[model samples]
Each structure stands twice: as C-alpha cells, then as structure tokens.
Target: MKTKISTLLLLPFFALLMLTSCQQEVVDITPPADSEALSASSPLTALMSSASKMDGSKDNIIDNASCLSIELPVTVVVNGLEIIIDSEEDYKVIEAIFNEFEEDDDYLEIIFPITIITAEHDDIVINNADELKEFVDECKGENENDDDIECIDFKYPISFSVYDVNFQVIDVITVENDRQLYKFLKRVKNSEFLASLNFPVTMVLADGTEVVVNNNEELENTINEAKDACDEDDDNDYGDDDFTKERLDEYLQICPWVVHEFKRNNQDNTVEYQSYALNFKEDGVVRMRARNGDILTGTWSTRVTKRGALLKLEFDTLADFTLEWIVYDIEYGKIKLYEEGGNRIIMKKNCDVVIDITKERIENYLQECLWRVARLQVDDVHNEKDYIGTPLKFFANNVVKIRLNGEFVTGEYEIGVRNSGFFLQIFLQDRPNLKLEWLITFLEPGLIKLENENNRMVLRRHCADGDDDINYIDDVLLTWEWEVALYQDGDVNKTEEFFMYTIDFLENGWIKVTDPNNGIIDGNWLAYRHEGLHLGLHFGIEAPFDDLNHRWKIAEITQSRIELKDLNANGEIERILVLEKKE
Candidate 1:
C-alpha cells in the first residue's frame, strides 16, 4: 500500500507562535503626514490584512480544506498504516508511501480529537468527523479565490507606532511574525488608534525579493503590484506535486542550484556535496561545478506523473546524483528532491554562482586587493583569532604574503587543478592553518571560500589602498597620543582606573600603553571596516585594559576625541568607551 505522510507544517496557519511580552519603551517619534498613516480604509491596510490571513491550502491532503489547517501532532491512518505526523518533513514520508504502489487506490483516515486553526487564526477543536466535515463544508472549492494574499509576506519584526485619537504617540508595537501582525492590524482596522508603520519596513515578494518601503504610498504601491505576481499554490496538494513538467523544468533551469543538503542511501553526504553547483541547461544538459573548480557534464530531464513531478539526472562519475528524484517540495529559491531508501538532496538557487571557474580569474581576483582572514575553522577549532590584524596579499608570480604585526611574511601559493576540482596550496612556515591544500568551494569578486577534510576558511577582499575612510581612521589614530577619558561599563563610572595612562597607536598593529609610574603594557589593535568602522583591541589579560578589549563600533571620531561603543544584537548600546588625545 502506497501512501504519503504529511511531514510538517508547510504553511503559516499550521505554525503556532509564542508571543513575547514587550515592555513600553518610550522613543522619539516623528509623526508622518495623514496620508502616510495606516488607516482602516487604506488599500495598503487591506492588502496587509489579506497577506496576513491564514494560508490553509498547504495541508489540504489531511483536511481537504483551503481555509483551515489541522494543527500537529496529528495522528492518521494511511491505507491501514497508523502514522503520527509531528512536522512538515513527514509529508515526504506519506507521499513516498503513496508512490510505492501505483496501482492501489490510496486512502487516508484522520485520528479524531484534533485542533484546526481557521483563516483568522482562530483555534477550533474537533472531536469527530461530523464536526470536522461541517467546518470543511464552509470552505470554498479547491483553488478558488480566498481572502488570504499568498503571493506576499511581511518580514518581521516590523514595528508600528500606536497613537491616541489625537495622533499623539502612545505605544510602539513590534510584531514578530504574521500572526502577531494580523492581530495587531485587526485592532488598527477597528479604528482603535492612529498607527503608522516605521519607515524602511521590509516586504517580501512571492519570489523572495525584499522591497523596503519608506512611507505609506510606496508600501501601498508595492503591495498592490506584488499581490498577484506569482502562483499562490492555493490548491489541495501537499506540495508542488501538481506542477506540470514544463513548469518544473523551467524552474530548475532559471538559476544554478547549489547543494545544501544531500543524503545517499541513508548516509549523510552533505559536507562532500555542499556548494557543488548544478546548472540545468535548455537542451537536456546539466553542468555541475565541483568544489575544486572542476565542471562535470550530465544529462537531465523532467516528467509529470501521478506521483508528482519527477527529475531524472544521469552522470557517469557522479553516481550519488544519478537517480530519478521525486520533486517533493519547491519553495522560493529552493527545491527539495528525494527518493526511497533515505536518499534526498536539497538544492538552493544561486544566480550569482559562476559555473566556469578558471585559474587566471581566481588569481586576478586575489591580486586585486588584500584579503582578510575573516573566518578560519580547522578540525572544529576556531583559529581566526591568531590571524587578527593579518591580511593576505597575492601576487602574479604565485607569491603570497601575510601582513602580521606590520611585517610581511612571504609565502609561495599555487592554484592547482585536479580531477576533483581546484586546490589552493600555501607554503608558509609557522602558519599551519593556511598550509593546507584547500579546495576552493566558492568564489566571487570580493570573497573566496575554501575547505579541506576538517577545515574551512573564508577570505574577504579588503582594498584599503585608496579607501578614504580607512585612511582617515588610520591617520587619526597614529597621529595622536590618547588616554581613556570615559569608560562606561553598564552605567558604572570606571573611567578613573586609567587616569594617567598614555596610549600610542603604533603602525605595527600594536598599542603601547604607558602608566603614570612609567610601566608599559603592549597590546594588539586593528581598525577595519565591517558593517561599519570598528576598532578591534586585544590586551591579552592585561588588567583594566583587558576589560576594554572588544570590537567596538567607532561611534564618533575626531582629531581630539574618539568614542567607541559595544552594541548588542538588537543594535542597542551596551558599553561606551571614550579616548581623548593627550596634550
């Protein structure tokens, strides 16, 4: 008996939320124009309400309802086989069972006493089939137009300022997800208070493109234009199993798909195949780029069957990917393919991935600028700390050098080609992490990703040669003798600890601190631009100064004074440090 298991919550309605209790934090508000506010009758409000509506079509296989979703963990009997569905992945199990026997009539029976969430996110308990059927009867026929706008979604935590009847700001509410947004909007729709969305709110289209709208007009126009941009997939099918062969083929060929997860015959091969890209061409041809910069050719085809959309790939050397895979789930920028016996492959579309990688191109990109060792993990041990303040420079003569503490350490580097792919080998004494024959897994204009058996390294290009900001920061630090003027550690006034300490920012990536008693403490410091301008300090357990060691955001900088602050994940200031030039 072939039956499919509904694995997990495929849509928002099935997912529950644990709403966080927020405290009222008063902030400065700049009220927008009347037209910029979100009112009950605004078209943008309607679009948002529609977009926030519960999409119940995802679990149609179990409930057969397009406006309601059965909350898990629901028990069901598929062809007399009792199965408990706890998550969305179980959907594949049920579908796999159904595809097992093509000739048998697949039937499913739901276990009673389950909860169903309605289109308005209301929960209703059903004890038996009669009660469930009555609610199901109220739902429109499959694929009919519904109140929910499935083609777009709001990227939370979007915030809105709630005002009193006079438009005086009262409260600011932050919504974490769709449910919370919908509930908040319901209050706004009822004219509870005048509310305006915070500017620069992000709206996600059906195809995963994010549009940031600054005001009400832009928000309204964006929602109206994207409401019907893509297929809503508001049918009874659990996945995109109803997609035609032509549609499936076209989707795969739109961009190169990079292997995110792979399992072959019950064995996890994700790391081995991760970042291996496959580009499906028009003429049944597919090109796979291996991690080592090697490209392999293969043949691909797709077909629609009673089971679902099927994608077949044939590659002589790539045996793991040579199978007829069932296209179980296809989402924005991603596709999930699986087969019986624990074989599955999850690929994500990457339009930026270059299929044709060459040695000259790699060398040219590396030589354009200095590369920072942004990330380094060898045998699960993070070693990037040792490479701090160090940047690698590549030259045309296969020569590479790392600037360590203001000194250049020369090394020989080579871009080697092999059957597996491209490999980068660097011969530098005392730097064992960079000595590995790393396979170049990913490469772009400003970034290079490399890995080996148990090591991974990510290098970000840093072209500081003509950067005005870097020059200004470097000149400011080197030209002045500074002292800790203010150090606020969570409201504590600890500035007096370093009353007479003089600081010198040396060009050799060293910070020399002289005490009032003529004692000196040496430390490492680097000023760089990432996300913003930052000053990285490392004192290595030196008293008082060690406490100031952190990658502090350069909040304010000038010839006389420099202010740096440590920010929390929410972009809130946690600590403040001020450095004033000594006369």
Candidate 2:
C-alpha cells in the first residue's frame, strides 16, 4: 500500500479531557515516582534535552556557526561564482573553490532571507549578514565545549504516556523528530503536566550502533556512557580534519586498509591500487601488499598541525602513494586522504582481509561458515533473489552443497591458481549462472567478492551455529501449524489466494504447505538477521505461493502470531503478511 502506517503519535496537549462521548476503559498505571519520572531540572533530563538539540556544525563552511544551521536550497556566492547549495554534498564544492589557490583570498557571500535552525530547534529568519551574525555570535567558538550533546541521539518515534493526578492514562504523545522531542521536553522541564516516557526505547550512538533500554535507569546509563564517546566535529571545517596525531595513528594501526580509490596528480590510478592493502605497524613501519603477493615496505608518520591532520608516507618503489596527504574525512571504517596536487586516496578498513593469500587459507575460510549470496549480477541482470534462503556449504575433498527447500543439492567446487589471480570454479548442474571460473578479487574472513567478464558476485559468511535468537525463532516456528491471517500487496488484498492453506515449518528449513484441494507444495525458509531479522522464502514457481517468494522483514512475533513486512527502497511497506497459529 502506498499509504504509510505511522506509529501512534500525538501532539503535546495542554489540558486533560474527561471521557464524555465514548466509554473506553483506560488502564490504571501508577504515576512514576519523583525520582523515576523525568524532571526538568534533573541531570538525566538535561542530558536528554541536550541530546535532542539540533546539530548545526555539519554545514559550518556556509554558516560558520556551531549552534545554527541554514536551511537548504539557499544560494551563496563563492568567490564571485553563484551556486545553489541544495545538499551537504555541495559543501565540498565550496571547500574546493576556497582551496583552489592558497595565495588568493577566499570569500563567501550568502544570498540571504534564509531560515536558520537554532540549537534549541527554533526557526529564525535572517535577511542579511548582520542579522545572521546575531545568532552566530551566540554559538560556541570553534569546537569549544557546548551545552548540546552530539555523540548520542534518541531514535525517534519514541513516545511518552501522559497521566492525570490519579495516575490514569490521559493521553499518549508520540515524538517524531528531534524538534518535537525538544519542544515536548521543555514542557516536561516546566512541570506543566505529569508524564512518563514509554519503556523499551532505542538510542543510536554516533558510530551507528543501536542500544535498546527497557527502563529509565538503563536509558540514563546508556546516554551517559555514549555522551562523550565520539568526535562531534564541532569545528568550522567541512569534515573531520581535526583529529589528534595520536588518535589518527592509533586508528590506522587498528586494521589493514584496502585502497578503494586512488588519484595522483589528477590522473585516476584506481585499477593499479584497487585492492592494495596497507598495514601500519609500530615504530614508523608500514607494509603494503599488492595483488600479485608482493610486499613493499614503507615508513609512515602522522602530525597534527593548526591546519589539520597530515599523514606522510615514504616508499621507494610505490611513488604514487608516497606524498604527504591531508586527512580530510575520518569516518567509521573509512578514511579519505587528499593533497593539493589532486592526489587522493580512499581506504576502507577490513580486519579480516588476508594479505598473503594461499590455497590453504582460501579453503579454510570457505569451510569455516555458511556463505550467503548477498549480491549477484550476471549479464547485467540481478540474480541474487533467486538464491534467497539458500546458503552454500563447503566441505573437504572439493565437495560443496547448497541448501534448497531444506534439502542439500550436491555440487562440486575447486579453487585454482591462475596467471591472473586465484579463481573459484563451481560446477552445479542447471545453475548456469554460477558455473563460471570467477576471479576472486577480494577475500576476507566473512566476505568474498568474485568477478567474471560480465558477472559479479559477493558472498557473506553466516555462522548461526550457537545464536540464541535464531534457535528461539526456529523453535517457535516448529512448534505448531500456521495459516495466513492476512496478505496485503500494495492496494490489493490477496488473502484469499491461500485459502484453507496450512503451513508446517520443518526443522531442516523446508516449509510444507497443504492447499485447500489437498495438494502439497514444498518451499525453502530461513530465518536470519542482516541489519534486522528476516524470513527468506523461496517457493519456486508454485501457483499461489509464488507471490510470497521473497525475503520479508520480521516486524513482530509472538507465540501464536507472526507479522512480516516487505519494504520498498524507501523503507515503505510494499506488502504485509501475517500468519497466526491454527487453533
């Protein structure tokens, strides 16, 4: 359905209402104790309030204000060139113009009458530079400590339950964004009404890790622990160029970084250094491994100056990567290094990358865990969907098996050394798309990237041997028979397609379906977690169940009911399926 099902959300209310038109029983929950309830003046409440404040430092190149942000689609003049700044990516254009010539003076003029969002999440209009400076003057001076917290944030759509003096539920207010949460917390701070936050709230840390807190105490602790855990990038620079020397050095030494992009003196050299890995060791020693198993030694050092962090590499043979580059962007598991002469390198960290690949190492990693076909493109056609719910297992003696419909399909695989590189060959009958001698381009402990002439594939390792969550799901699904309670596809109701159908989930990953006419159909089913939990189903070309052959996200699950949703590219629900246990 195109219509989105919004979470139960309510605007902040000023007055409590008495039941008059309808009689609905309100569950009586005791009012939170003074210490348990969110108090306006309490430290935890203050932290939450600060965390909800608008972070305006991301576009500091345009506003130069740490506590204020200029709304997008604003036009600005950069050195006599007028450009429409629509998104954050356009900020790099401005930075590039400013850094074009060091001898020339840089300037930026805003075509004003723009809206600015304050740290308090208030929208203000500024007509000229003078009017904008009024708010800019109030911001912290270039990365100085401020009242707003930026290292952790509350995952939105969280809600609070409003209560009356007698502790009876009066209303439930849902907050959809930071602005709404900030305004609502102000009421909580002023003691305008009695309210308590709903339990089991989720918070996201700066590094994109999610933490779920079930109670007030856990929430408080989670916030406190993550409040100061990351670099907020509060400076006026566009990216994280203000890293300390020690921090930058330690970060590089954590894992081996593979070059994803490379440019030297305005010439692209990505193909030559595509998979070249760099390992920064102690005592100024760095090792570089080439695709042909050649190891090159280099000296590396870092120094932080008033301008920014600089990384210098000295290699006798690898001259292209031997320049002193400015560290412009430091993100999780990635680093962006650039220099003035159009030299740049983008490296991504991979702790499991095998620098010295051998026949033994390749076979060991293949047999370690089950491999899921995460991506496959053959002859410009996407083919990964056909392999859903099927994971390949590698065994000893060149034996391979793919689980399909809870049964093992025999196959043969071989790892061979070629003049170009290591190649993986698969011989599976009736699977012509996967029967190519694919060159292994990238290899890591949990990942393998393979490429043929016009085909590419990625396999991600999946080890669920002892995962308690998967085990629990498997047990719950096998306990009883289930029937489709609802099936919605877009604006169409397709529940009757599987009328009187009974589904039995077997332990070996097969689903046994009995239709209304007593005809039996077998399908494959797998429960796994990637970003979130999902139920992968593959019914082949079965008449009615063919429409249900896709990986559905597990939205909710209980002992008797399971809710699954298929989301589109924008995360909107495209289809929903609900299965309830047979009574």
Candidate 3:
C-alpha cells in the first residue's frame, strides 16, 4: 500500500482603519448694493457680494447673500445602520465614497453629508422671485425639525455577470502595495464557501489590482507579485492574466490514508502502515488500514492555515507510529507545500550474532582429570630397592585443575558427506611452558574414522609435500598426531636422547619415531595436532640406562598420563590429561 499524509493551517485576519479630518479657513467679506445685485439677477454674485460685507463683522448675518459656514453634526445610515458626520462639506466629501460589498447579492453603495444654503448677507438681493421662493421653501423644510434627515440614498445592486468565475484562473495581488484590494476582499462577508475549493481563484478590483484568493491570499499574492516583478522590464505589468490557477482536484482525489508494506532481511518480520487524510480537522481524527487488513482510526491535527483548501498534519510517532505531516497551500495557479519533519520508516535486514563460552563451563561435561609435576629428585644409590616403592609423591596442590564455570559446551556440529570432514575449534588459557600432552576419543565419528592426537601445543594443518601421493596430511584433512621429549640435567646438551612420534592409525596404529643423532641431545620435542585422537603416553621409569654399553634397558613401566587435546584448536588446549597407575 502507498500512503500519503496531509495537513492544513489557517491564515490570520487583517484589520484596517480609515481616518478623516477637516480644516476651516476665514476670509474677508464685502457687500454689494441691492439694486445692483437685483439688476445682475445672479444669485451667486449677490451672495458673494453679501458674504464679503459680513466677513469683518462680529455679528452673524441672516441675508441670503451671506454664505454661512455651519458646522452640523451629520450622520448617514446604511441598511438601517448609521455613521456620524460633522459638517455639510464633510458630508459632501464623503458622498464620493463608493464601495462594493462582496455577498451573494453583490451590491454597491455610497454615503455622504447633505448641504443647504440659507439667507444671510448685506449684499441682500433676492433678484429672481422663483429662486427666492425655492430657497425659502428649502430653509423652512430643513429648519422644521432639529433632527437629522436622510438625504441621498441610491442603492445599486451589483451584477457579478461581468466577471468570469473560473476556479483555475486566479488573480494575484500584493497586500503590501495594493492595500485597497486587501480591504475590499476583507470586507467580503460570505467567504465560507472558499474552504471547499481545490483550485486557485482570481479576484479583480476596480482599481485594476488583481489578487489570488486562498487560505493565505495575502501571502500568496505578495509572493507571486514579487516573483513576477523581480525580472519584469515594464512597470505596468500588474495584471491577473499572467497568473493561471493550476487545478489540484485530480491530485487531491488520492487521499492521504493509503497502505504501504515494509520488509526486513534475515528475519521473518514485516511492517505495514497507511495514511488516511490530507486535510484533517483539528480534533485529530483519521481513518487508516494496513496491508494485512488491519484497520486503524486516528486524528491528525496542525496549526497551519487553509487558503485554497490546503491543510497540514503532524504526528507524534513516539506516542503513536506515524512520522511527520505537512500541509500545502494552493493559490494563484501554484501549489506551495511545506515539509515539517523527518521521515520515520526504516527496514533492517541480515545481521550476525556471536556467542561466548567460558573455560569452566566446558570442563564440566568434558574434563576427565588433571595433574601437575615438578623436577624429579632421585638418590644416586644402586642398591636402593626400597626406592622403587618410595617414589617421590608430587603434591596435587600445584596441579592445574579444570573446573566447570558456565553453561553448556555443546555447539552445532556439521560435516559434509563423502570423504568430506568437519572440525571443532577450542581456545585455551595460557600456562607456564611445561611438558603437556592430550588425546581425543570421538564417541561417534558418524561415518568417518577418527585419527586424533595432540601434535603441538599450537595446532595447525599440513599441506601435502612435493610427493602428494605419500599420504601427507593436507590442510583440509582433519588428522591428529603426537610426540614427546625428555630433558637430562636440565640442559639441552646434557647428553640425553630426544624422540619424536607421529601417530599413523590408518597404517596399524604404529607410532613413527625420530631419534636424535647428536650425542648430547636434550631438546624438548613438541607436537601439535587436532583433538580427535584418543592417544596416551607413558612417562615414568620405563628403562634403565646402560652407561658402559650406551643403551637404555627397560626396567619397569610406571604411571601413564592421558589427556584430550583441543577440538577447535583456537590457541588453547583442553585440560583432559588422565593419571595412570604405576606397574
């Protein structure tokens, strides 16, 4: 399953205030003769001459010629609402204010103050009888009551038929420079339907300012205009035709709640997750399903704004299992998506495991016996038959003892079929250099015969020599052999014999030996081999030396020592030597 998550964020509201003020200036007034004004018959001329005469007077004039500047507190109402105005000139100035109210009904309205002229100056000349009568009637009607009156009320219901309603064509305008466009759009009260749109919408103003409508309409307009004007050569290019709304309905059809599968190597574990919604409600609710038919229902919540129906989402993976959520803004033919956090899905496969086994634990089911020996001490007396039974007793205290420490010493043992073979590795602790030997008896060799013996303290395999057919043990062949050496007078050259032995079980269990030809040979012969050979060595008073004849005679066989060599041979030997009874 493929899953995609989404979220939405709301834009902030903008506030606007309109401030207006007025100033009054005084001027000298002069009066004109009544006969002269009557002959001229111009009401404006007669009024102006009368205003000039009263200009310097401290008393207020009452003639029709004087222009009285009256400061009246005026109020205009719209749709049963009223806003106060101070003077007639202020009211007239406000009369030019025209605005379009965005609504289903779409209407245009203007509100302003009303002004009236009354009789006042010394250039008093009511020249025309009709004009005098008209002025008198107006003054009477206006002064009839002190209460304010509604004068100009022209309602023009707007027709949206002039503008094309295309969801994919958006008009983008910058809020910073084009403040009038911002104010006009902000006044639109019926914009709730904008939340459901999935395409860019353009808004064109009377002042030729175009803006794209979305969740972040102001931001989108500003950014788009900035980007467009960055490389523009013409300064009059602030138009809406340049921007086209890119439809996103097709993309939004693929909802966020989709399923995905994840697998790991070297393991039988798999994970599946699904995303449910792109524009989630603040209540944190969503619907999801896994690939294994598992259904999960939850909520996604974020603080992002929705300009053109774009929302953002965020998830608490630790608290839940999801990663991150991001909301995109669709405006002015462009989609701006914001990425918030890191991706959380991961798969791990194929790993190696290691296990460690201690020496004490291996000795429990494997160790047979242990022994230690010091330098032999004998008295130089030929008639000492009592010395035979009184052999020097070696204390067992100095003997190296093998004790079990850990758990099982068993491991998976495998060998290929045919002449094929397998091997086991054993690691041992180091000890002071001493004459040691070992042997191994496989309880079950399965199909192959086991020929094992302790060759050298450090076990290794041998490659076939120049004569490959001479039965030379190949490195791949698992074979075991052993050898021994005796030292006299503690010196290698103290006049003694050295012997080396190789166990050849296939040839009749005959031990091949190499004797030292040097007259004063006393070097210790070391033999290392695998631990599968069950061989033992006898090391006691085996013979008496014939000093005159220079040949040793067999007197009596003493104690026989036996030990099991290392199985895996990893720099350590198994302490399985056995003590034998003297004959």
Q: Which lDDT values do the candidates have, in the order given?
A: 0.81, 0.84, 0.24
C-alpha lDDT of residue 549 in model 1 = 66
Relative to the true structure, candidate 1 reaches a TM of 0.58
Name model 1 segments beyond 4 Å from true: 1-63, 67-129, 138-141, 144-230, 237-242, 376-382, 405-412, 418-420, 427-436, 451-456, 463-500, 506-512, 515-524, 527-535, 538-583
On the 0 to 100 scale, the lDDT of residue 18 in model 2 is 43
Segments in model 2 whose C-alpha atoms lie over 4 Å from true places: 1-240, 243-247, 264-276, 283-285, 288-308, 314-322
Query: All candidates' TM-scores?
Result: 0.58, 0.62, 0.14
Model 2 agreement with the true structure over 445-510: per-residue lDDT tens digits: 888888888789998888877988777778889999999999999999999887899999997788
Winner on TM-score (2 vs 3) = 2
Q: lDDT of model 1 at residue 504?
A: 93
On lDDT, the leading prediction is 2
TM-score of 2: 0.62
**How many clashes does each candidate structure show, in the order listed?**
20, 2, 63
**Weakest 10 consecutive residues of candidate 1 by summed lDDT:** 13-22
Estimate the TM-score for candidate 3.
Answer: 0.14
Clashing pairs in 2: 1-490, 40-189
